[model samples]
Target chain A: MTKSKLSQQLAVDNLKIGSHVYSSRLIVGTGKYPSEDIASKAINSSGAELVTLAIKRFSQQDAISNILEVIGEKKLLPNTAGTLNAKEALRSAQLSRELFKTNLIKLEIITSSENLDPNMPETIKAAEMMVKDNFEVYVYCDRDLNNCLKLEDLGCVAIMPLGSSIGSGRGFDDLDDLILLRNKIEQILIVDAGIGVPSEAARVMELGYDAVLVNSAIAYANEPILMASAFKNGVKSGRKTFLAGRMSRSKSSIASSPTQFLK
Target chain B: MSRIKIQLNGTVEQIESANLEIILNTFAPKDRPFAVEINGEIVPSAKFSDYSIQENDKIEIISAVGGG
Candidate 1:
């Protein structure tokens, strides 16, 4: 009935990344699912338009489940996971482009196995190479402002600043830095990693991130299907609330009821 | 069989025919999507049939694995 409600209902702006635009802002991962059936149902429920995959080696005799069949129309984001250097990451990117038939790459060269944080220097070099090679790089770098700016300058389509380390489920607590980065950079801003719950995903989206990439939170859940649905709602709610425009916070508490009445 | 040895995904194997296609057919289904590298060089799918594998070559076949 109100203008606010009307806008909330119509908060369906298409998310643009590079030359491509998508309707769903929640991007899910195709990893860690206990089974293909669960993976299929979870992603189907999540309302995700894209999913990330790690390119790995499987002997032809090994019968690993085909991820493409489960994703079903969702765009695939093949990442350079498990690679520790720019050279290896480059090769993985090339292979991913060939296999996924998409230019999009989540360029990640982790510094270590303990925490899958992007090694800044390696990531930057790989991003530069990938961009030059005509691949749309969605870089997974730290939330450092200058670093993000450099990545944008390198012609990456999107910059993913971690909420925390990958798969840690640490969530984005001190999101002020990310907010600052988002304000300064003109490129697509997506929160990737360290998100452990639906509320965390919603919070990041509410903070004005273009999208969020989620995996462990859902895939490792006791009930992945239910968690996936929760994430769908979370992203929707957060996007809606963001578009509706949240009321400015006050330094002091503002009473909704009559404080003078003392009831 | 006049076999030569090549390393496939970290395992050494003996093969009579030293071709990428033959090795690939032994491990992967033709219908699936995958990429191949011989001694760290990407061998385009178009050239799989012609690319010859040599003794002690490191062959890597990377396919789609789920991840975020």
Candidate 2:
């Protein structure tokens, strides 16, 4: 491998937000599976080291004890999914830390239900508080580069900029913004939400993102295990492609015509 | 009756009698994310029937919701 290729590999390898090491560079969630068994199988098939779980009321019930038991060996990441303010986000972070025994948190402070857009001020406040409390914060922000930079400045260990919106599956609607965010932040940059298919994940990886966090895309698939495997392969292939260093694009077509014969 | 002790997901607990449902119900109300580990082996909630508790058998009920 060339120096640039080696660096690219190292960059992919270094996407760990805290103590977790994920080879696939794609983190999945366990929420939307039809059953716990299927969810467990999908998670195992995905080969994701870290998995996200939205902290909700059902978690407190005993009905899902079996599900929790199945995922005992994997790292459980709790998200502040429904939290609207900094206080709620902080409380959720604390609860997650207490329940999951891990300081890693995915900060999601939504300001509007329609767009599921992040409240920048609330997200910044929550990030500051959670980081101070010794949590490795991964803030999910808007696709705007400015919001991502602001979150990075607030001490977030990683910045998860959305591609469109949660579960939109639109897939990289703003490539320029994502590229700018990747360039501006020194910390980990993960493409979270709005990814609809495996190719979207591959595209994000190809764009030099550190990782991709997915949930509904895989969970809602008709064949989740197969989709999980597809995502795993896509992420790996995309990372490898980025490491190999893609050729620069040309404005005009360079046809391989018989130039020598013509001359 | 002798004291039947077991490990619940790594935590040690002593309960009287070998009734599985009662023991599980006791710990269920705690609202902690846990899994039952009996005698160094994981006992899925579905298989709570095949194995009966013996005296002094270490039962570990591991809780996922622990302080970071």
Best prediction by lDDT: 1
Docking class of 2: incorrect
- Across all models, the iRMS values in order are 1.3, 9.4
List of chain A TM-scores, every candidate: 0.92, 0.89
lDDT digits (tens) for residues A138-239 of candidate 1: 999899999999999999999999999888888985689888987898889999998999898888788788899999999999999999999999998888
* Candidate 2 error regions (>4 Å): A1-14, A58-65, A112-115, A255-263, B1-68
- Best-fitting candidate, scored by DockQ: 1
Candidate 2, residues B1-68: lDDT per residue as tens digits? 67866665345677885876667777653544544555545566677655678866776544432110
* TM-score of candidate 2's A chain against the true A chain: 0.89
**DockQ in order:** 0.74, 0.05
On a 0 to 100 scale, what is the lDDT of residue A26 in model 1? 91
Q: Write the per-residue lDDT of candidate 2 for residues A151-254, one digit (tens) a residue.
A: 78778888898888787778877889888877787888998888889888888788888889887887889998889899999898888787777988999988
Please list the residue runs of candidate 1 whose C-alpha ends up more than 4 Å from where it truly belongs after superposition.
Answer: A1-12, A252-263
CAPRI accuracy category, model 1: medium
The number of clashing residue pairs in each candidate reads 3, 15
